[model samples]
Target: MKNYLNSTMIKITLMIVLCMSAFAFNDSKVSAKDEAIDLRAKAAILIDADSGKILYEKNANKAYGIASMSKMMTEYILLDKIKAGEISWDDQYNVSKYAYKISHDTELSNVALREDGVYSVKELYEAMAIYSANAATIALTEVMAGSEKNFLPLMNKKAEELGLKNYTFYNATGLNNKQLKGMQPKGTPEDGENEMPAKYVAKLAYQLVKEHPDMLETASINKKAFAKGTDDEIMMTNWNYMVKGGIYEYKGVDGLKTGSTDFAGQCVTITAKQGDLRVIAVVMDAKEENGDSTYKARFDAAKTLLDYGFNNFKMQEVMPAGYTFKNNKTIAVKDGQKKEVAIEASKAISFIANKNTTYKPKLVLDKKEITAPVKKGTVVGHVEIQGDGYGYIMPVKDQATVVTTDDVQSKGWFVKALGGIGDFFANVGHSIF
Candidate 1:
């Protein structure tokens, strides 16, 4: 880990590191750029989780009804509260009439919350994440903020904090008023429906996992029983087909959520890991084929995007050991045993890059020279990997440890101070010349 740049500068730098290749996955054949996959999604995005690099996107910034995919934020807020010690996983809450109605409604998915049944925070969260239990989410919201109405403000505040310009949370469960059968509070913004751009959702998912990685502990659960040891106990299975043993389960798919609705159609946000690389892929508003709108389109689209990434991209060290940046040069080191210390990369750098393109990175130093007493492992410069189609600019810091010159015995304090003053100006001159 290294201090690379300010947040804004890193974003700007990442935005510029791109190469657009004309290729899209269709069946087993890689088609021409113009023949991009007909994902039939309103919006989508595939990105590198570590580098924030966009691999592919279609209408990624356009807002659309997000359906249950909005629950990721809910999960984020819940974990945040729990982690903050405001709540505990063992704390119990009784199911409300509202929660019971949604659970037994049969029209929506649920883990069958009974108004009389008491459940722990952990149980409800599991139902929501793995089973997309609408009632469980509403119930948890009730416990968290005393009621769904109060919880709405917290969700909106979080969205703003996250800088989600294209997202709006209207309900804890991602349902619109119509889906709620008029149960939604009237005249309140939270009573409406939720909407967000596909890319922002991806960013949200990435940020959620990055910060609260332990959320995956429950999100990855593929199957479990609700109300265990009680007569009301019911089995819950993950809706995300990308998970293991799912109908369309792909390799490496782990914790994630899926969503579907009349307006939102079908959607999924997925995260997967392969060795050093982790990626997030989002598919939203997937169209139903031949009026048979099943979840297959969303699954297939997500798979296609992920397949495009794992097959075509490889994570490479931006400036690995035993390699030198093109612009790196030896600089004079005052009071050192050696007259000069060779400038070298200080830290490790790696990024997901296109397998098809060759990388030729350039090195940029913050300063061309340094004074003696420079400690080992000091950061003096960074390596900027040139972008290509799918190229991402990652600044690998130049570490002081990599600089090979040694320090010599100093004369007396006065002598060393005098030598430093003269060499400081000299090094500055050399830097300019």
Candidate 2:
């Protein structure tokens, strides 16, 4: 009986050990899943600036309220006009009643434009970019398109041109139309405000940097006095706290926009560069752990994305130029001096990838064979990298071109005729057999 009791006790101990082992295994899986970075935003996206490759995204396509961030589009249009010579930075704007009223409203960001004050485009742009001055943005819209009403279409048109699909611009300043106090753009409801998905917000920021890189010069300024030395001078501080010298100052953080409103919550779009890698992160409607929106929450979300990008990914050459495919090193060339010609990648292909992941490339040929006279640089196919979760932000295939390695001249007419005759005789002999 004692021996039987010992065996039963041993069985019970084994069962307990097995149960604990199973629980530990399940707990490990949960920990692994929890390790993924949480952006703490309603929508967010991370992308490589140079290549336009998307690295990470969460609910990036759903449109949400975009407050002062709309100033980016306004800034884009003004820059475009300046570049086209239709407007000059020194051009003066006579503040309208709408601008004057909004400028005085302490609830919004503004530099307090005087009713009779003549503000230069440069000063107003500085205020709008640095301080997110709502009145200054409205005034600039009037200068560009003659009125905020007229500017709305241009904003939408530019959004369409930039390949932004889900977006709406109700006003140039991104303010709720009700705040406009009956002066809102025509046809927009009083409750309307600008709205855009995180994807398009990142795209707009990308285009802004790509087209008007100098915009960063103004955006990077942490603080500036509007109309310095004048009685009307008002000190303007950049709302983008990530800029150098600001609270929550992050290294490598530069020109970008930040936004918040009752409907929009806290939001921010930031670009940071470390070495050769520059990343753009957009976080919309960020919420705290308790679900309350706070100014720091948006920056925290952006920081998480930026950290994840810089920490987990690196730009590495996946394939070099002149790389030859293993299975298709050479392609058949009909009616040429050589029966086949070697092909290789036209340019070096580099991509941002996780350190732990091994990405394999696949060659997709336009054609398996080519007719005579192929030039050395003739494009025959493209190379595509697989296993990367995201692709280029642009609506196109992520690929690099492959080209012929050397020229292949057509065979002489006599040689071609002889080869045709040989083929015919060979067929006849097979039939006879």
Candidate 3:
């Protein structure tokens, strides 16, 4: 009995091991089919501008000092105010003594606004966006909300409205927290320096451009004169070197922002478009080269991230609008004049996937059998595209019109008579009511 039991136990163990081995093999195959991206930045993300889908990320949720990139939000709010008629491009604002001092500090990025010098909203914006000028940004902030102190609430409110969860702003200029301490309004405690997860930054960038595409007009301009041709007209150059004619300029690269500080290291938020598709990439705290004064790491990382997105992905049409999936597309119908109803995709859908991949369409019906009396535009099911290392669902398109087929028209005369009687009574009741 002992020998028989031992043999039986060995057999059971062998079967279990075989099953585990098979499952492992299958998991590996699935894993091999997926694509991946790598980044050298401490935190980074690449996302589709339209869908807001994250295509790739590394340490994306880790908070890092975003430095001047915070100006993206400042500019966004500024534009909103301008659109609401609270301010205008031609409206002028006076520079405060504080702004002038910060501009000349030599430690902070500035466009050197003279105390008492007045600049139109447009000119100050050009300086801030193009040069990452802290002083111009602060002046604009003061003008917008009465003072930098009163502006924090508005900025925070906008942040919440935009669905930002991983960030908090200390000042409008993205200045270091220490420099902004005195600027905080009384009763409002310092929240420290501004920081955000790379993903949130990417989301903000996408939202910024989506809501105000014209902002790109400012971002894309690599060179503009702030007081043109005057001795004070400083030729402000965009710090984002990835734009046209910049050192790391990539084809189709346009306006955005660059940032760095002792704490934030080096960072950048970028957007570029090719055809109808646009991509946003954010990189923060990239490793610097020894003795590197130019902050080359952030730019290099941004290039790599953008190239990875443009080169590895292609937008493929899963289904075009008004496409009729008629071939074997009939869906079974219950109690219908017709045995089956034809179906198609309801709308067009496109997905970004690997360049060389192919996708297969799959129809998933809400129910296996669609009851009769279906309308022309009824949503019966959804289409799922498989392959290409990606899969997504879209509403299925069905035939233009479907009603009980004539197959039921010849139903027994008794049934037809009953239907006529019922209609007569329903009409009578309606009239009486």
Each candidate's number of clashing pairs is 8, 0, 6
Candidate 2 has a TM-score of 0.86
Q: Pick by lDDT: which candidate is best?
A: 2
Question: Which residue pairs in model 2 clash with each other?
Answer: none
Please, what is the whole-model Cα lDDT of each candidate in the order they appear?
0.76, 0.88, 0.75
In model 3, the runs with Cα more than 4 Å from the true position are 1-38, 185-191, 229-231, 289-294, 320-330, 357-362, 386-433
What is the Cα-based lDDT of residue 125 in candidate 3? 90
Question: Residue 142's C-alpha lDDT in candidate 3?
Answer: 86
The lDDT ranking, best first, is: 2, 1, 3
Residues 68-147, candidate 2: write the lDDT tens digits. 88989999999999999999999999999989999999989989888889989999999999999999999999999889
The alpha-carbon deviation from the true structure for residue 414 of candidate 3, after best TM-score superposition, in angstroms, is 4.8
lDDT of candidate 3 over 1-433, digit per residue (tens) = 9999999999999999999999997655321034554456788887767767566777777788998999999999999999899999999888787777777876777777767688889988988888998888888888899887788888889888877767878778777756653654444446567888987788788878888889888898888888776667777788998888777788777868899877787889989887776889898988754535346888888888888778877676766755555564667765556667666677666767556555566666677776665666667667666653411111123212222222321335676588789999999999999
TM-scores, one per candidate: 0.74, 0.86, 0.77
> Clashing pairs in model 3?
219-255, 337-405, 344-397, 345-397, 346-396, 346-397
lDDT of 2: 0.88
